[model samples]
Target chain A: MSTVTKVSSRYERDKELFLRYAAIIESSDDAIVGKTLEGIITDWNPGAQRVFGYSPDEVIGKSVLILFPPERMEEEMDILGRVAKGERVENYETVRVRKDGKRIDMSVTVSPIRDSSGRIVGASKIARDITESKLLHASVLEAERHFRETLDHMLEGCQIIGFDFRYLYINDAAATHGRHSKKALLGRKMMEAYPGIEETEMFAFLRKCMENRIAQRLENRFDYGDGTFSWFNLSMEPVPEGTFILSVDITNEKKLQVELEKHRDHLQEIVNERTAQLQEANRELESFSYSVSHDLRAPLRHINGFVELLQKKLPSSIDKECLRYLHVISSASSEMGHLIDKLLDFSRVNRASINKSDVDVGSLVRQVIASLAEEAPGRSVDWQVEKLPDVYGDQAMLRQVFINLLSNALKYTGTRTTAKIKVRSISGKGEDIFVVEDNGVGFDMRYVSKLFGVFQRLHSNDEFEGTGIGLANVRRIIERHGGRTWAEGKVNEGASFYFSIPRFIEQRG
Target chain B: MITRLGRILLADDSRNDVELMLLALGHFNLANEVDVVRDGAEAVDYLYRGGKYAERGGQNPALMLLDLKMPKVNGIEVLRTVKNDPLLQTIPVVVLTSSREESDMVSSYELGANAFVVKPVDFHEFIESVKNLGFFWAIVNEPPPVSRNGGEQLEG
Candidate 1:
């Protein structure tokens, strides 16, 4: 039969079926059109008119090539060629141009059209606009790529492990931290890449996070199988695949802490050894002085005793010169004895440990002046004393210092008809300075350096008799108390002796 | 009542000190009242009348002048011996020494020394100290009467 006759016969036999198909094509949201095998449109629906922004009358005789862009025209030809051979092309996604000259995304399906006699004459096509869905999908893919790129470039190591403990992904930092390339670690089991890793504490923690989907953190000193170890502050979180881990290397900080502790311990040991050595030296020095006092004084006593006895046994007619020589011998020997005693006193003050206390230096000075007055009761002395302040020092030792200073003031001023001895103390920034100023026969400034030396004297024995150890003892006592001593004098003028006790001592205690 | 003669014992290691001590005691005319031992051991022996003094028997000395730093035995040990003994504890022991060490003085007093005197370096002061000691212990200060146990031990 002719094609037109066959088409009419099919429609004439199933008028109800023809009406149902016609209504579905007319109401469908997708574009439905009938085209000749040469890619021309013969029938068009309202959906097609809305999709392409064209009316059915304007496109019913037009070729389908008018709907495709130049780049998509080639693909349309391929689709039409397949449809002409009774083959169907389903979901052929492509780009197209609309009547408004705007580009749109589309998914199209084309099938062969058959008459009642089962012969193909043309094709039927369906197309849907998919521009909004395609835009959403492209944005999702871009966001995923951003996260991947960020993880790859981070300084802290980032890694993703699969449920089977295989390395699914490793960032550049993670590969560098592990001292391996990403190509070598990816898709490889952790235990296979790092032997004995399964036995490690880090592995146990990672397993717990992977299996329980729990988050955990730890500090791990990872040993690299090559006898090298590194420290990492590791934080793990449960991810969909298995676990995600971030690691920060802290080996330098750990090593610095260990080195600091070792250095402190070494310093403590050295300090302990030095303290022990000082204590031993002090003990030996104490014993040495004890024997010196006991043994050295014996012979002096005998010499004096024999000299006195020799004088007593001599006759009354003994020569005056001989008698004078005997007197010199006795006096010289006694002076030597007194010098030894003074030397020993100085050493004892120097060697003994001191106990610090608040001392009333003013009252102490008064007491010394009273005692010194007893020694030189006959002298007409004009004493000008000031109120002195208190200080932190060894009470007994400070008393010794005052005794020496006051006695010196009293002795040197013996030449003065009216001795003016002023005792006063002034508070300094870090020290409390006391002064024993005297209007006495002062010394030369050139010899001030020898003022505090042991057995160093400014005057002759005949001028002012002394053992020359008073200032020496004073210096020793003051130094032991962590103080300084200085003297200012001009010959025949007044002399000022100054000593300072540092105030920091009280604060430290 | 058995009257025990008052005898004094002087113990010193140095011959020079012993001679000087005797000379100073002579100033008070009490030298003959004293008996001497050269060292701490000799003094103990004489008190017990053991070795050199065994052939000679006498009463415990009324006073003992002890010096520290002696050979064979020390002054503290002798003082310990005498103070621990009931018979000899009654005799007054005075430590006269050249050592001014506080430890020696503390030890002497803690061990029951009747008096402590540091021997003066000056011969004149030495003689003055001896004059006072001689007059007080031997002449003025009354010695404790010999213990009844000591008298009985001697007589029995």
Candidate 2:
């Protein structure tokens, strides 16, 4: 009777500790439930009631398959059979159905509980909601796949390599031309994959890219094993993790470049040949003109000499008409001779070599004016001489320029009784400009373009006695000195002729 | 008068010029005689007292009028030979030519010719120049004395 009383008291204490554990499990947020080894739900705490939307009374006799998704219930039974073999399952994440048929992701930890005889009595399970973490993992996997697809499928051949010269990745196109598969290519050194590539400029170029840790593009020739060679345009982009190379085959483009260079050389040869022919023709024309002028003088001299003899012998025998005819013929012959001489002079300016010296323009102008005055002492004119600069030029040629200009001024200003002629100098930005201005019978400005052309005249021959070659000759001489000449004039007021010479005479200096 | 009228030598290639010269010489009524040669060779022969001209000339002419352009011996060669000879050097040789080119003028003067004149083209001017030349050389300018040795030889 004492033993039975003792057993009853121990049972009461064990029931109290069980009630305390149940109260703590009910207050927890984690779903705590008990299932039979046959997969039937027997015990459910308030935490399980809130999590699965099922009360303890409603789930006590139901199968645990009520919480599993319909598609996964059979799979759960197989997994539970494994768990019942004394294997505790941890972190088994799966989709489950709640009371309202809503799906939720839960990570489950289940342990098999044992009785005094060590036989499995039930299974205790702890399930937690992890839906947000599962969705985040899925998006990360999708982004990684997208990045890999774009890099592999890009049109330009791309390769990623580690600093140890090991290739981490090569696209499908780059691997196809190689002797190895993409899997075998990874983790292989650059030289080991392509043996001769180490000796090429590409090797040095990659070294530079690595040292600078910058992007570089290299044009190099790659000799394939089959005795064929190809040119590759390689772009190396250095990243902190590794280096990326983008290669393009440019062999056909290089051949086109060589052909273009040959074509360019041929075109230059044609131009050189044409220029030679033109220069030969020009030289022939110039010599022809020189001979025509030089030989023509002899015959005209004979005609003049014979006519003079005829005039003298016919003193009493000739009539006034005959004398006048003889005078006219002689005069015409002389004028023709003068014209030919002037033409030759104009043409010869280009043929001669220039001898340069320091020319004092001031004294040169004075001498020219004095010579002109001596030629026409009877004419009254006011001559103005200005201070002139020293220029580097051929002294004789410069003297010829001043002589022609000043003489032309003196002759044209004949109509004015007290003609005023001004010789002055002015400074231009980088040149010395001199002007021989005359208040004389100026010409129409509209015909100024014709002024420097040989035999171009603005006045009637009877009015102005000239062969009309002076200004043309002057223009030629000044141009040869690296200078320019031009004139401005009105109908009758005056004319000013300006010419400039570069002070720095580089040729012959 | 008799000595002055002794002889004169004219060398010219043109027939017309020679005829005019003779007519103008005719105007000078002095007792001076005139002889004409067609080229420099004949002139050289007559002055050197050679071949055909050995016996015709009583003495060398007072002056020789030399025309420059002729076949065989040219005027410059003739002048050079004459001036080199002791007997012929004393007699003044004047260069007369149709060429008025500066080279011809300068060459004749440089060769020790007494004077150079371009033959004028007009007929009247030609006659007047010849008349003036004749009056000046024949009458106005004093003539160098003639050589007395019968060996009055020319070198050209």
Candidate 3:
């Protein structure tokens, strides 16, 4: 009876130890599960309920295969069969589904739970949820792959150098720029690859960028020492390793710039030579003009003077026809003399250096009209002068232009009973165009091209008196002021002469 | 006889020019007192009382009519000599030439020429111009007294 009582107390102590172990298993953070050898769930703790989103009552008799993905169902069989055969599976990683259908990456450790007979009947598994840590690891690997892809496909030469002047990473373009293979260049010092690289201009820039942690740029010619050189535009920025370099080749563009500069210099030489020749010709023209003025007029003066003396001396003895012939001779000589003076004036207009200033053309027109008052009384001349802008030009020359144009307008309109002359000007882009329109005897359009030529006249001397040098001088003065001249006319109807003066002159040294 | 004017100097190269000038001035009988020289050298000699004028014995002729483009010396040189000299500078100088060049006019005026007259090719205008200047200078205008130093006198 005493032996029976002692065995009962020991049995009670064993029951208490079993209850404490069960309580520790219920509160474990990891899911602790129990299953039969047939892959059916036998026991599920509170940890299992929290991990799989299921209660113990719901999965106590359920098939453990439900927790496996359909594609990995065979994994359950293999793992459980190994456990039944008494093999311990520790930290086996696999994919499993929760009750809410969210998949998780898990680390599982399985052991055989045997009966007292030392035979495996069920398996005890402890699993850890590793989804967040696994995703973080995968994303880091993805970022590394993306960085390699971006640097490998770049067209500009991109390279990263380490602290010892070694190539840590080099792309395909960087490899081609150095004329070396990427496999042979990486992890190798640039000085070892290219023998004299340290002495190069680009090397100094790279060294400075590495030491000072500052960025630098260079368009330098790198000589490969085989009598061949290439121009490179290199940019270097300090990086955590050593230096990051980017380079683009511009050898052809530099060559084109050199060629263009040489061509422009050659063109300048030609322009200088041509200008010298033109100056020489102008000097000759000046001397010729001087000769015409001094030598040619003296004889004509003598001829006219003697003719006048002959007329005065032989007045009573000479017949009327003879006196008339004498008169014609005198007139012809003076006319020729007048022509010489006009020719000299035309020549001098081109040769004289222009004095440019702001000139009020309206006042100049009024002054010319006042001078023309001597030619005033014969005809009823109606002049309509518009308000004109002040133009930059030689006042005396521009005054001569108005003198010629206005006088021609007045003279050519001699036949009109009521002469109407209008001096109108309109502002244009970078210029002002002035029109001297008149209701006068206009010229034939067929002969209009000859209007501004020296000694070119449209009307006979009996019809209208002109030396024809007036329009030519006008054209010369306008052209010298950076302007142009043209005209429109119809025979016996009217004529409109147009001349333009620039509002602004482009400065030249 | 009330002689109206003093002797006037006429310097020209061409004999025809001298004849025409005489013809123009002879209308009013003003040619009687005009002393003609064939070139600028003789004109200079007559004014300086040297060379052919070594026997000259009168105040430098009443006026000098200088012609440009002479053979030996030019009107500009002759004018330079007369206007630069103290004794001859008092006489008036007129440049009567065939050249209407602006440069010639500028040089003449710059050299202290009293008047510049471009001889007209028209004989009637030539006669009118010569008559006007001749009448004004020889008769109407009076000459400075025989004072050697007649430039701008320093004011006290």
The model with the greatest TM-score is 1
DockQ preference between candidates 1 and 3, better one:
3
TM-score of chain A of 2: 0.64
Native-referenced Cα lDDT, model 1:
0.86
Query: How far off is residue A161 in model 3, in Å?
Result: 2.3
Predicted complexes: DockQ each: 0.57, 0.09, 0.63
Q: What would the DockQ be for model 3?
A: 0.63
Evaluation by DockQ, superior candidate among 2 and 3 = 3
**What is candidate 3's TM-score against the reference?**
0.71
Instruction: Tell how far residue A502 is off in model 1, in angstroms.
Output: 1.9
Q: Which segments of candidate 2 are over 4 A away from where they belong?
A: A1-75, A90-109, A115-117, A124-144, A159-231, A235-245, A251-263, A301-334, A351-378, A383-403, A423-436, A474-488, A496-509, B1-156
Tens-digit lDDT track for model 1 on B28-138?
Answer: 667887889988899999888879988655567878999987889989899999999888888889998877777789999998998998777777988789878877776
> Of the candidates numbered 2 and 3, which has the greater TM-score value?
3
Interface root-mean-square deviation for each candidate? 1.1, 5.9, 0.7
Best by lDDT: 3
Off by over 4 Å in 3: A1-106, A111-123, A128-136, A273-288, A305-326, A351-361, A377-394, A415-450, A478-509, B1-119, B123-156
Model 2, range A290-384, lDDT digits (tens) per residue?
44553454455456656766787786867899999988888777777678777767776766688888888998888888888898988998999
Which tens-of-lDDT digit does each residue in A195-264 have in candidate 3?
8899887898898999999999999897878898888899998999999999887888889988999999
lDDT of 1 by residue, A358-448 (tens): 7778788788888888898888777667777777878899999989998899899999998888888888888889999998999999999
Query: Which residue pairs in candidate 3 collide?
Result: none
Two-chain complex of model 2, DockQ on C-alpha atoms against the true structure: 0.09
